[model samples]
Target chain A: MIRVRDLTIRVGSFALEGVSFTVAAGRYAVLMGKTGSGKSTLLEAITGLRPIEAGSVELLGRDVTRLKPADRGVGYVPQDLALFPTMTVREHLAFAQAIRGWDRTPTEQRVAELADLLGIDHLLDRQPQGLSGGEAQRTALGRALSFRPRVLLLDEPLSALDEETREGMYDLLRTVHRETGVTVLHVTHSLTEAKKLGDCIFRLADGKIGEMA
Target chain B: MSSRRRGTTPSTGRSDVPFLVALGVMGGFYVLLIVGMLVADVLSTTPGHLWALLKNRDIRYSIKLSLISCTITAILSVWVAVPLGYLLSRYQFRGKALLDVLLDIPIVLPPLVIGLCLLILFSTPPGRGVQQFVQVTYAIPSVIIAQFAVAAAFAVRTMRVAFDQISPRQEQVALTLGCSRSQAFWRVVLPQARQGVLTAGTVAWARAMGEFGPVLVFSGTTRGYTEVLPTTVFLELSTYSLEGAVAVSVLMVIVALVVLLIVRVYGMGSAPVGGR
Candidate 1:
């Protein structure tokens, strides 16, 4: 479960005041806002990439506001899918587990398992540059979900895909949510996507988060 | 109304001849200067005479010292540049701007002034304290130190550009993936910077090979000891050995060309990681 209360953050002249939201455990929530609406800033604050002025962030019932990003155990896939270009798809899947000191055998097993689940087993040896939009999306999603974090935060994950790829991704995302039961807070500007996937929708405008009727 | 077919190719209707000629003229001047100087050097002597000069013990010693010193300088430069460059590129501290300017001092300062400053620096108690262990003035170590003083600046600049080109988002993503900051940098960032490291090493080596003024002033052009290629050029010119000077300069140019070619080919091999 992810809960943020009275979160406030400022960047230059832009400000987000009293932004509050929650995603119940095992629920897929979508946060929607138009471009330049400080959606990324708020998401970054929760990810510990940006400092918050006044707020409390609780992840899996533990207050993570003062913790480092690595300590938060939160999986984040940015808008650009910031996949390390030098690493193969298998390496990306193994990255988080390896960081936690997992041995090569178990790590390889887990990587193979995730690659099979994400349907990227055939492309495991390929770098990200060779992957298609849906392939890359699945790769990023697999990487994020590899460590089995309780909360998965996606920042505009499908904004850069074509219609066909986005449609396939919608199904993939739903499968991921159902299979893992990880709390997901997906940020996007598309209501169509929200209605397609979100169990609850939160809207951000005028520097505040509100529920859509 | 006359209807004309649109061209399939993306070209302007008229050739940009006059504009292109203007650019060619300005750029051709420097190209002419370099080619003209090389032509004159080749014309000054035959290949045999240049080859014979390499037979001289002192000249051979100068070539060996130049190669060794330049390589050492390059290694030392990269060792300092990588950390300093990463620090400058990824962080914003209170005195960062000032530190940046300070780093550029060797690049911008007159070589003679830098040598003089080193001379004065060594005269101080701390320098003497260091000298008590091993002499640094007018010695073999002084030659490498003098070359490093300037060449490291160039390496640092190249490394800073390299680090700047990579997105911090990669490291941030690594952190979210469970790596600590240092782990993220070492595992993800540094491996991708291999091309930059090669480029910086080449630049530092070339600069060290051509560094003359500080080595001349501080190391004193002692033959077979501190006389690198650049100072050897000066020694040849002072002794009216035009053939020697031209030949050494040509040799330096050839070494530089080979190193740059190696770097460019290797750089092309690893170009994919040059982006985010």
Candidate 2:
């Protein structure tokens, strides 16, 4: 389970105040908000990229508020993918495995499996620049999962995809979630995606978070 | 016949043309000057003498010294510049504008003034006293220090611009991916900024290699020890070794050409990032 309490951040012209939330272990929670609604800021504060002026963020029953991102054991798939453009898809998976101290043979086998599962087995040698939005998203997902974190954070994972791809991604994400049983906190403004993928929904507006039926 | 009002704009004419022409002319002049110098010097030296000069002991030693010292300068420059540039690019703080202006001081200050200041400070007992630890007066250390000061200022400016051009979102993503601040920088941010950093390194190294005034003032012309390419040229000219001077200048031009080629390659790769 992941829990956030009294999370507040003062960015340029906006402030997120006293926001609190909880995600049951192995559940998919969607955060729905328009642009600049502090959805991304909340994610950042949780990830420790942005400092939280007043907050306690706990992941999988451990206090991770002061911990570095690597030590926090939460996988994040950013909106832009942030896939190292300089690296090939296979290399991205390999790097994640390497950083987590996975052995080479197992890492390679795992990477192969993930690539096959994402249907990007043929695109492993290619760079991110050459990949389509859906392909890149798959690569990013592969990278995040290779680390096998206790929690997964998806920041607008389906935003760049076309409608057809978005629908396909929803299915893919659902399948992956069920197979891995990884708790997910997905941030998006799409009502359709929220309704489709969210087990529970949290509406974020003007820096406030409220649970919705 | 209808008035053919196709694509011409009356207001966008003289305003742009005059300014662009002025800018073009200013840039053209430097290109011409450098080309003219390289052509003149290479032409003046006999091919045989030029070949021999390339093989000369003195020329070889100066080349080695220049390459080594300038490389050290670039490495140290990047070391100091990276953190400072990253901080300046990413955060807004008190006195940031003042700090930015201070970094620019070495770029615009006359090299002679920088040399004189170094000399005045280092030549005195107090300066010498401080120097006792590092022992920079009239030494290779002083040469590296001079090059590092000027080149680091240049690196800070270029690198900060490069870092600024990268989106903060990338680092944010890295964080969410479970990377610490330093890890995000090491894995994601630095990898993205590699070409920019390499270009800055080449430019800084070239500038350090060709450094003259401050080096001459601080580390005087001690052949085989303190002398670099430009200083070698100056020494050869005073000693009436015109062929040797021209030869050294030719070598300097070749080094600069290589740097330019590297920059061009980096520029091509970096263009797409900027376009985004």
Candidate 3:
């Protein structure tokens, strides 16, 4: 569960004030906005990557407003995918578990399970540079899901893909949501993406969020 | 070919052939000048002079001091450059531009002026206050301080460029993935900057290796103590031993070439991700 109430954030000359929203546990939510709208900023704030000026951010019944990003327990996939160029896909999937000091055997087992689920089993040993666009997307998705976080945040994950790849990813994303049942808040400018994937769609404009039919 | 096609490229190209020749001639002239200088140094000095200089106790001390001071300076410069570079590349804060200009001051200042400034600074009360504990003026430590003043500036610029090529996105993602700021830096950022750190060290080492003017004014060319390679050349030249100076300079040139060769072999890896 992710709940943001009356959140206020200032980024440069732009600001979002008195914004509020909620993604019920296990719901796939998409926030749609124009290019410069504060969608990414809001997502970053929820993930504790950015500071909030007012109100509260609650995840899994705990207030994480003043918490460091490390303690937020939210998996974030930024628009660029931000893959570690030095690590292979398997390493990337194993990273969170390793950082959190999970057991070695369980970490490997989780990596294998995610690779199979994301259809990246064949690309596990390969670096991110070798993966195609959809392959990279799946790799990043696998990495985000590997830790079994309560909340997942994605920023423009499919904006760079072709039409065919986007369609494939929509199905994969649905499958991921079904398999993990993690609360998701995906941000994008595309109404079609919002309509296709979101169990609940929210539109952000002029620094406020409104529910969409 | 049609007249238009022939007239467009081949004929026009022929007309500008002299312009191309002019550029090549100027470039070739500079290369030839460098080659000629090396050849003249080789011809004007004997292997015996180089061997004799190498055998001189004081000159051997100068070589050892040069290695020690240069190594220390390179290590110190990199220690300061990495975080300073990361700040300049990653964040914006009050006085950032002022800080940027301040960092460049050492790089743009005349080498002699730098030494003179250090001399004057040491005479001030605060400088004197530190000096009371450990003497810096005309001491061996001044050699490293002089080298660091200039060498660190170059290292800072290289590290800034290195950090700039790597996007902050990776660090942010690492933070989101249960790693603290320092952990993200150590595990994610530093590993990517491994080649860049080596490049900075190489540049600092090379710059400090050749530092002359500042070391001269600040540390002095004391025979058994403060002398470095470039000052050794100057010391030989001052004594009217032109052949010995050329031989010592030839050694400096060889060391510089080896450092350059190493930098070329293993420096400046293009970061695979990040940037604008």
Task: Tell me the DockQ of each model, to 2 decimals.
Answer: 0.68, 0.37, 0.51
DockQ ranking from best candidate downward: 1, 3, 2
Q: RMSD per prediction, one decimal?
A: 2.6, 4.4, 4.1
- Judged by whole-model lDDT over C-alpha atoms, candidate 1 comes out at 0.89
- Check candidate 2 and list the clashing pairs: A69-B178, A70-B178
Model 3's CAPRI class is medium
Q: Candidate 2 A-chain TM?
A: 0.97
lDDT of 3 by residue, B75-120 (tens): 9999999999999999899999999999999999999999999999
| lDDT for position A77 in model 2 | 84
lDDT per residue for candidate 3 within A39-116, as digits (tens), equals: 999999998989989999999889999999989889889999999888899999999998999999999999999988
Report fnat, model 2.
0.52
Candidate lDDT scores, in order, read 0.89, 0.84, 0.90
TM-score (chain B) for model 3? 0.85
lDDT score at residue B206, model 2, on the 0-100 scale? 81
How many Å off is the CA of B249 in candidate 1? 1.5
TM-score of chain B of 1: 0.91
Superposed by TM-score, candidate 3 places the C-alpha of residue B267 at a distance from the truth, in angstroms, of 3.4
Which ranges in model 3 have alpha carbons more than 4 Å from their true place? B1-40, B46-48, B120-135, B268-276
